[model samples]
Every structure is written in structure tokens, then in C-alpha cells.
Target: MAHTPFKSVGMVGLGKMGGAMAKALVSQGTKVFAFDPNLKETSVEGVTLVSTLETLASEAGIIVIAVKPNLVEPVLAEFQKPAIFVSIAAGISYSQLVAKTPQGSTCVRVMPNLPLVANRGAMGYFCEDQAVAHVERLFYGLGDSFRVTKESLMDAVTGLSGSGPAYVLTFLQAMAEGGLQEGLSYEESLGLAMETIEGTLVYFRQLRRKDQNLHPMEVRNWVTSPGGTTIHGLDALERGGFSTAVRDAIRRATERSKELGKG
Candidate 1:
């Protein structure tokens, strides 16, 4: 039988990510037992704040490790059996956790971005056979879940989806700044940038729904009129090596992720 529902969640770090996760859990009717050494906030109605890691672990049936990559192994050492462990740390692998925690312990490693705080996170998770179902049930509340077949592809997923939000945010910031420089108010510029991105996503989804394998170039062609402003901007971006820069960035991020996984 599959693990139906998790009764409680123990979050070790109550920083930004952990705090967001705790809130998401509570919203899902899971009792969250949260802890942090440097917590500056009080307990919520559904989230019971604990003082120590061990106490939180002892009470949780599902433990979500939201701490940094360096801290994962040490934290796993204290975790006991009969509970599923889901980690959102960047570089830690499932093998490391299974070795550190008790033998036969369920483990899943997930890479989630900042957007998950709003339940819109695009996350990739890989798990050992023992823990796959449990992790799926727990993480479906967060956002989209991709069950990666090989753990090695996690680095690529990290590069694509994990670090993707910051890249999009930076682009949005630049677009907004450019709009402001074009005489639009700051708020107006930001609003325009946000809607443009949102509408583009909707358009892409609609195209997919129509069974179209729409390439980015094809989409650009659809919008670019002959000698139009859009075409001029595209020419400038092409000259600036925008596509190459993005490709190199993804490559570098993937390589760094590989290095991190090794560590």
C-alpha cells in the first residue's frame, strides 16, 4: 500500500524556503513541526515550532530537509527510521542520505526554485524505489513534479528549472528598466513586463494544446514583421549574442551542479 497522507512535517531550517514550505504544508492540512536555530518568528496555528532538530525529527512521519547542501549529511545522521525523507538541497544525492540515515530508509532529492513558495514551483525529484510514492504524494502539493529516471540528469534539471527563475527574473528586470527608460513609469513598466511574460506563457501553452511543436524562432517569426521594431530588437539581440550567452550560462550551471553533486 502507498503512504496515503503525511500526518506531520518537520522542517529543520525556518529561513525563507523552509518558512514558505511550512506555510504550504499547513495550507494542505499537514501539521508542520518547524525548527530553526536562528528563528525570529513565533508559531502559526497549524505549525508547531520546535526548538531542536532531534525533537522535530522524532515527531515527524515525513521530514522535508530544506537546509543547505553542506548540512544534509549531518542532519541525516540524526534522522530515525519509519519516515520518508525528502530533501530540497541543491547538490545532495539520495545515495548519501540512504547511507547516512538508517539502511532501507526512504529518500527523495528534489530541486525547487523560489517560485514554489507561491505553489507555482517547477521542481524535479528523483527517488529510490522505496520512497518514490511517498515523495510524490508529499510534493504534489508544491507544484509540477518530474520524476527523473537517472540521478545524473538532476544537474541538467537544476540548470534548466532550478536556476531558471533567476534568469527569467533578471530578464524581466532588464525589460522593465528599458521600458522605464522609454518614459513609462516604474510601476507601469514592471506591470507591462510581468503581463508580457505571463501572456507569452499562455500563448505557448495554447500552441502546445494545438499539437504544435512551436520553436522559439518560429514564434519570433510569427511576431516579427518585415523591418519592424520587433525585428530590429531581435537583430540587436542576435548581434549581442543573447542566445549564445544563455546557452553558455546553462552549460556552466550544469557543470557546477555536477561538481556540487560530487562534493
Candidate 2:
């Protein structure tokens, strides 16, 4: 009685992200057809691997472009059929992809980070109204999915969540270093860093169950007691302009993602 989405999905790259996504889809019991030019011939159990882009498009209703940003246009130009084209390239904008594909093409621009390999990644997608619902269904299993009303907001997503993992890892590294300085062994320091971050996220989840009236800054203030060790660390971070540095990093990454779309 209800209409279902793509029965078969196609992936145009067998690289890290693409390969992992295909694996995830197969694990979900969806049929996946994938392509990689470099490979002579290979198969991921449950996934059908093809050598050419045309074969990928022909087999699936949804064709995903997961190649490097620079390779997007050239790869799309090779597809002859009219399968819905979904671009997962970091900086390839929907407009750019549509222009490069055949006339009357349905295109969606999706940004998925590495955590998607584990199906816990956050994805941001923006597309024409015709493709939005379908794209949402396709990525429903990938992770948390959000639809961006305006294409321009994609750059902000790129800045925040696209590059967010690197910032998180940097924070973990710093925490581990701090633990080492505090007399913990190397492995023990890393374990503490990981556990501490995990606990922080769990605490935030619990806090969300409440009214959520307390902002992150309020929570920070609540923890940093006057003249305590936490305050000492906070003082060093404040003097070093840590928050400002993170803000600038996001700004630059957003700008770079925009530039990549143009290229």
C-alpha cells in the first residue's frame, strides 16, 4: 500500500567511505552494486562489484557519487542513464553536480563523515524537493539525517559536522597528553582520555532529559570550582584563547569546503 525507496543502490567508488557505505547497506539486507576503476575485479560479500560506472547506474535506481571532490564532474559525465545522482563528495555542491550531469537530472548533495562507516555518523543533505524525501530514506540507516532548506547552509554544515571529528580527536589527544603530564602511563592516559570524553557525552545525554535550560557554558561554570585544579586548566585554556581558536578553525574549513565546490 505504501511506496518504498530504492531496492538496489549503486556506488561509484570503492574507496574507504564508499566501500564502507556499501557494506552497511548490504548488512541492512539491501542490494548494493559498486564500481571502482582501479580494481581489476573484486567483491565485497553481499555486494555486487562492477568495473564501469555505466554498469553501476544500470543496476540501481539510486546512484551515489562517492569519489574524490575533483573526480565528481568527470565521473558524472560518464553516466548515460538517468538514475538519481547523490553526491557525497565533500565540496561538490548540488548545483555543480546537476550542471555536470544529463539534462533533467535529479541530484542531491550529501555530506557524511567517517563515523558513517560505523553507521553512527551524522549526515547533512540538501536537494531539490523532488529528491529530498528519497534521499532521506536512503540515508535513514546511515545515521542522524538532517535536511538543509537552503543550499548555502551546506557550507556551515561542512564547517561544523564535516570537520567536527578532527576537532574531537584533537581534543582527545590534548586530554591524553594532560593525563600523561599528570603521571599516568601512556596507555592509561589514552584510556582515561577516551573514557572521559565518553562520559562527557553520556552526561550531556542525561542532561537533555531535563529541561535543557542550562547551556554548555553554564555547565562549564558549574564544574570549574573557584581556585580548583579544573579552574587552573580552564584558566590556561582561556588565556590561550582555545575557544577562539576552534571558531577560527571552523571558519577556515567552511571557506575551504566552499572553494572545493567551485573547483
Candidate 3:
């Protein structure tokens, strides 16, 4: 379904993710009206800084609530316009957002990770059918996004992409440390580890684009010759239960997300 193009957008926060998103929207040619009491001025081009949320609501058709989860309710209460509301506050559900706004308002709950600062974030959202296209277009500038059919699945999304960055960073740190143990300087090891992960991701994406159905293990096998160094590393990982540990981490995070939502 075709979505009505937004003429103007409002943003209530100007933190890292919100600022990045505001910049991205301006780059896409959308007129943005923003209100952030903490900021004296937002230096982004095409963003009009409003004095109050009421002024912002009056000027924009859609309002993005980018404040912290605990602050979202109070922010929503300030601007009860019947605009399409897009929220990025973690663990806040659609029902909670709806209850704070006026009748007929549309609420979209989105879970976006830290990578949004670089416009490479992964976002999963749930909203009514009518709002899906609009929400998708709004977030596409920040990177890949998918619609969550069941709101319950958003907890899993939070567990994965939401908290996944820290997990990846920890793994990267371990890899760098291992390299350091082998006589590489800290900076050199860190650079090598980052590049290896980045390159591997690019190659995996290329394979996916070509519609290849090969599993990651298949690709790993192609490089792991008999009695190779890669095999030794693989054996160490298996003995450490690396795969199971990763799964357990995600499972625990998902459960935590569910618990947070309950509050």
C-alpha cells in the first residue's frame, strides 16, 4: 500500500539516536520541527527548533518520541495531537503509548539499536496496518527495518538486535585480546579484528544477495582444511560451548525484555 508522504516531522529528543534520525530525515528532504529543552540549538539543516511540544505538534504531521522509556509517557502527555506517533523508547508497548495520546491517534512502537547513530541500525516495529508503510518509510533512512506481526516478538527483537551490539563488541574485544597474546600490538589487533568481522559480514551479505542457501558452517568448512589453524580455533570454540553460550545470552536478554515490558 502506498503511504502518504509526510510533509513535516516532529522530534521530541535530540540525543545521539534522535539527532542522527533528525539529520537523516532532513537529508531525505522532509521538513522537521523539533523540540528538545536540553538543547539551545540543533545545528542540523532543515530542522526547525520549536520552543514547545505544542508548537511542534501544530507544525508537523508525525511526531517521533525519542526520549528514554521512562520519559515517554510524560512526553506523550504533553502533545496529545492526533498525529502518527513513532516511538523508539525501549520496552514501551503500543498500548501504553495509545493510552497517553488522544483518540484516533496512531502509535507505532519500534525497537532500534545503537547502530542507528551511523544510519546502519536494525529496527523492528509493530503498528496497525494503516501505519506500516508510513513507519517503514520513516525508519528506512536509518537502515533495514521489518514489521513485527505479533507485538510479543518485539521482545525477541530487543534481545537480538537491540542488545546484540554489546555482545558483538565483547566478541571483538576477545578476538583482539587473542591477537595480542600472539605478539600483535593492541591497536593492530583491534584493527584486524574489526576488519575481519566487517569483511566477513560483507561477504555473507553478498552471498545472500546471490540467493545462495549455504549455511555459515558450510562457508567455514570451505576454509578449514584438515589440521589447519582454523580447525584448532574451531575445536577450542566447541569445547568452550561458544554457540550455546551465545544462544543463552540472547535467551536471557529476551526474558529480561519481557520482564521490563510487564512493568
Candidate 4:
């Protein structure tokens, strides 16, 4: 089924994720109407600021609720019209959104990470079949997106991609520290670490695009000789339980996500 594109988008919050998404939409030449009671100033251009949610809903075909999870209900209550509602509030489910919204309104729940600020975000979402295309269009240029079959898997997505950036940042810091210990200056070490990560990711992406069957371990093996520095480093990482720690972090985060949904 073909879905009509949103003529105008309304943004309910102007915080980090909201602001970034608004800017991205504006860049794509989409009309944007925004309303944020707490914000007095906005850095995004081409967005019309509205005084209330009712005003925004009246003008927009798609309404994006980017407020905190706790504020979602009250915000939805203020909507005077039915629109395609896309929410990025963590731990909030599609059923919860549907319950608060008007009957027959379309509701989609998305878990988007901080990288969205740079237009390289990773988003996971779930919605009714009728709403998938619209939701995909909404997030097109913001970053990569995943559509989950079951809403419950959104909790796993939250644990992995939603909280994954922080884990990567911590790993980057450790890599930089390791470089510093090897006598490199702080700035040089950090720069090198960042570039290495960025370049490796680009290469890995290209490889995966060419052959989806390729595994990450195969790429790691490509660089590690029979007896080389890479192998030594891998050994050290194994001894330090690096992989185990990462898995545990995601496991704990997934459990917390389930808990948050229950509340």
C-alpha cells in the first residue's frame, strides 16, 4: 500500500533528539511546526514555533512526540486532531501511545540514539503495517533504521543500539589511553583512535554491503597475522574479558528497559 508523505511535521519537544530531527526535516525541505513550553530559543532554522500542541496538530499531518516518557500522556491529551504520531520517547510502547491518543490514530514508537544529532543515528521502531512507510520516510536522512516484527524486541534494540554509543565512546577513551601509554601525546592519541574507529567502520560497512554473509571476526582475522601485534592485542582484550563485559552491559540494559516499560 502506498502511503502519502506528510505535508507538514509537528514537533512537540525541542531537546537534543527533537531539535536534531527538526533540523534534519527542515533540511529535506519539509515544513516543520515546533512547540516546546520549556524552550525560549531554538537553534534550528526553518521551523515555525507554535504556542501550543493544539496549534501544531491543526497544521501538521504528522506529529512527532519527542518529549520525555513521563510527559507523553499529558502532551497527547493536548492534541486536538488526529495525526500520524511518531514517538522517540524511550520505554514508551505503541499500545501506551495508542491508549493516550484519539481512537483510530496511528502510533509508532521509535528508539533513536544520540548519534542522531549528526544525521548518523541508528533507530529501531515498531508500528502497525499501515504506518511503516510513513515512519521510514520520517527518519530517512536521519540515519539507519530497523523495523522490528514485535514491539517487545524494541527493548532489546534499546539495550543494543540505543545504549551502544556510550559503550563505544568508553572503548574509544580506553583506546586513546592505550595510545597515550605508548608515548603518544593526548591530542594525537585521541585523534588517531577516533580516525581508526571511523575508518574501520566505513570499511566494515562496505564489506557487509558487498557480502552480507561476511562476519566481523573474518575482518579481524584479515588484519591479524600468524603472530602479530593485532593478535597480541586480541589476546590482551580476551584476558581482560572485553567481549564478556560488552555482552553483560547489553544484557543489563535490556533488563532495565523491560522494567521501565512495566512502570
Taking all chains together, each candidate's TM-score versus the true structure is 0.91, 0.93, 0.94, 0.96
* lDDT (0 to 1) per candidate: 0.82, 0.84, 0.89, 0.90
lDDT of 1 by residue, 187-262 (tens): 9999999999999998987987886776767886898999889999988888999889888888888898888878
For candidate 2, lDDT tens digit of each residue in 34-125?
88878766557787877777777778988889889989999999977677899988888777888888877799998888888888888888
Candidate 4 has what TM-score?
0.96
Task: Score candidate 3 by lDDT.
Answer: 0.89
| Model 1, residue pairs in steric clash | none
Candidate 2 error regions (>4 Å): 1-5, 41-43
Instruction: Give the candidate number with the greatest TM-score.
Output: 4
Provide the lowest-lDDT 10-residue window in model 4. 1-10
Query: Largest lDDT belongs to which candidate?
Result: 4
How are the candidates ranked when ordered by lDDT, highest leading? 4, 3, 2, 1
Superposition error at 131 for model 2 (Å): 1.6
On the 0 to 100 scale, the lDDT of residue 40 in model 3 is 85
Predicted candidate 4: what Cα RMSD to the true structure? Answer: 1.9
Better of 2 and 3 by TM-score: 3
